[model samples]
Target: GAGWPGLIEAYRDRVDIPDGARVVTLQEGNTPLVAAPHLSELTGCTVYLKVEGANPTGSFKDRGMTVAITHSLAEGSKAVICASTGNTSASAAAYAARAGLTSAVLVPQGKIALGKLAQAVVHGAKILQVQGNFDDCLELARKTAAEHPVTLVNSVNPVRLEGQKTASFEICDVLGRAPDVHCLPVGNAGNITAYWKGYTEYHGDGLVEQLPRMFGFQAAGAAPLVHGHPVAEPETVATAIRVGSPASWENAVKAKDASGGLFSAVTDEEILSAYRTLASREGVFVEPASASSVAGLLATAADGRLPTGSTVVCTVTGNGLKDPDTALAGMVEVEPLPVDPGAVASALELR
Candidate 1:
């Protein structure tokens, strides 16, 4: 069971991190595992949200990026590169800036959210807009990284998974054991694999009494796992998860089978509903893809698969501010009124 101490020591000794990498003080793990009584009440289970939005780059990608960039620096690479829907690029840009390395991000043209794009730009990445989708960009990045001096800092690198496994350790620490079930949205599917690895290692080492069932949800339009093949053209409003072919496909399948987990697809409508529910009810404003976990949980609960009073942990992987446009969809614009007290009282419905 390589929980905190063992995992940290293992990462330091086994992983290929730089000897003296400069990491941001705020760039470590230990994100909040907040209780969501509202969601718990609805599901008849004690539901907890692993709020990864609190990560330094506003997504769980920082966990992986820190390790990936550190390894890149250790290898003496002057530049790092990645293909991202949004979060990965932002993380890479920030970490590269911290490590004093140039970052280059390839993104699908007109696909990424404004805030994510802004983060990459502000962090000084050379952002390239590919004419095709995320898969296309990823392919180009892989080829470019292979042919050039820039290090590929994507989830394809094993070090990223090693770093991301820390989330599982943190969850076990807070809950005192593995929850009955763990759910999360899967894009490239590396996160689920990492969680499974963490949980298995922890259980093997006697840190946890048992392993939790992993549940991975993907956007219906972009679900290669459920569909049993990659989509030629993946589409979803949850831009962060509109992946056609996940790079870590085999490892994700291994996680599902090893943990007795389920892989499912949720519709766009369901994703949006969960997004609003997390925002208004649970008071957790996460990006649409992050809501996919809640969507799966609600669906599984409705199907009577989840037991009452069981502990369920859902990983909300990113912050809502990364995609503010989704939050404003179908909303009416309000006109500003005069700055008078009378106007304020009138707007407040005071007679």
Candidate 2:
């Protein structure tokens, strides 16, 4: 067996897949769980970053899209549809192209990051920018898929979670056990729900002796779970997480309750600070929404709420390149240097 089999091949003996199905893969799993020394020192807790941006499509959504598209092809579906902030569409479009199925993506108008948008478009997806929020796009996608002969590849599809759950398996395999705590940026809430399910299944089957407490964080302006009500006009600089309502709301709550975890909110300012910190301090660059977990971690640490010396893993969901606009706004530009070596030395103050 060659090393680095895709998730389906890697876990085929453990989980269910379509019978006799050819593995459709972009090698979406087996991301690095890099240690975050600075974060660990600051919080007095051991922290590791689940660098999901290393996935083929530059986001964790590739995990779900792989399974969803594979299942759709096996089921003889000629087309697939999904609603996404950005990453989901890109993944779906790419996979659909591979599977020889049509893909359609519905997105919120003028909201998604340009990099993600470029992926979906280049992959030949039929993109619809609805003049509404993510919730509205999701609703329309579901309705369209139901009324037509198309399969919806959103996280609402069980096959997507089946693929995504493998992330937990990888983590457990690497750690030799589950960490004491797992943190994530919650948008549609499906990720938190899927992770809790994974940990529970592994523990039940004796793969793990313990399970991590699921700590979910959301943008303050779009924190439906934290507020106990959906915000009609959710707004945040973390465009990936600008969801007013979560599809997996009840399941997310269940994960929190079952794991003795809590849902929390982080402001845009805090998210940006964590974004900058991850890049400058830890040399890990991630999108603004992906930094929400780190921001929440620091917030809890500052308030003396985090348990000291505990092992923790934060899922960074997307690449920083996905949202260059947020990373560049208000940053100082470096002036071009002259060709002369002396000019370069002068600019560096080495003279």
Candidate 3:
């Protein structure tokens, strides 16, 4: 709401949002733009974290689902369906429950994180584990939505991208200007597209002096952008981004080229290392996929691609709690000790 029209107004003409859709918000936007001293020191750039993990569902997907579900409800739809890697299903299920509408989510079998799967189940979504990858599941979901009365809530639904663009607006409002570069992890690639659109619109309207370069990163094993082709069997330890084909692939490409940005892939090892660094050094614990942004930024900085003192923001899209398994990986377990205060104090590193 900073020097701009209402959230709904920004996308009313650009996207095919439902007519007369009533807003039922959980105050989703306006997330903190926190300065990252550790990242800044590492990159020699002014680094900030757009912490989307603070969203209602512990992920940025909440922003999109709110609009998608609201529009679906307005259109007289009693049920909605989606294919998700993980976070999208969780958000859709929770929002559908809040709206008192039936929701169904198709996910790649055994690929989703435990937390997300639990959320979908607890939110009462009809969860289907398709014996295929996310792309296959998406195809099934699209066919199902077309054949049935259920509305599809994926990023392809336009309303989702409209809502997600608010993140960019929030960043601009907090910084009072667009940063030199915006880095984010890419899964279905919708988030990057929305961010680019938001920045371009803000610049076009004379709200900002210049647009930031849009840098998008994908997990190395799941990176279609870097590969220059779709990977039918995309794999990554970052389960949330284990996507083969991105729905907004062309849009993502356009965003990168139009902004003079780069689309690259970070290895699983690099992603995990960045995650640990964010948690231990930066005090920001995010999901492994979310760490890809920081990973990309560090990589670019080391390669001298990022200019010193440039303002940069990395979008950490999800909370570390979403994938607890990664947090436990390589962690040492402490054995039970006698019920002695001195023993406990010694174990806890008392002087």
Residue pairs in candidate 2 whose N, alpha carbon or C atoms collide under 3 angstroms: none
**Candidate 1 per-residue C-alpha lDDT over 1-351 given as tens digits, one digit per residue, 9 for 90 to 100:** 223332334346433455675433234567899999999999999999999998888999988887787677767789999999999999999989988899999999999998999999999999999999999999999999999998988999888998898889889888899999999999999899989988988898899999999999999999999888998899999999999999999999988888888899999999999999999998999999999999999998998776777799999999999998999888987779897999989888997
Clashing pairs in 3: none
| Candidate 3 TM-score, true structure as reference | 0.95
In order of appearance, the predictions have TM-scores of 0.94, 0.98, 0.95
Q: Scored by CA lDDT, what does every candidate get?
A: 0.89, 0.92, 0.89
Task: Quote the positional error of residue 92 for candidate 2 in Å.
Answer: 0.4
Shift in Å, residue 154, candidate 2: 0.7
lDDT of 2 by residue, 150-201 (tens): 9999999977888888889999999999999999999999889888988999
Q: Can you write out model 3's per-residue Cα lDDT over 1-351, one digit (the tens) per residue? A: 244343455445544566577754555666778899989998899999999998878899888887888898888899999999889999999989988899999999988888899999999999999999999989999999999999999999988988898888888878899999999999899999999988988888888999999999999999988889999899999988888899999999999999999998899999999999999998999999999999999998998877888999999999899998889988888899999999999989995
Clash count list over all predictions:
1, 0, 0
Give candidate 3 regions above 4 Å deviation.
1-19, 349-351
Stronger candidate by lDDT (1 vs 2) = 2
lDDT of 2: 0.92
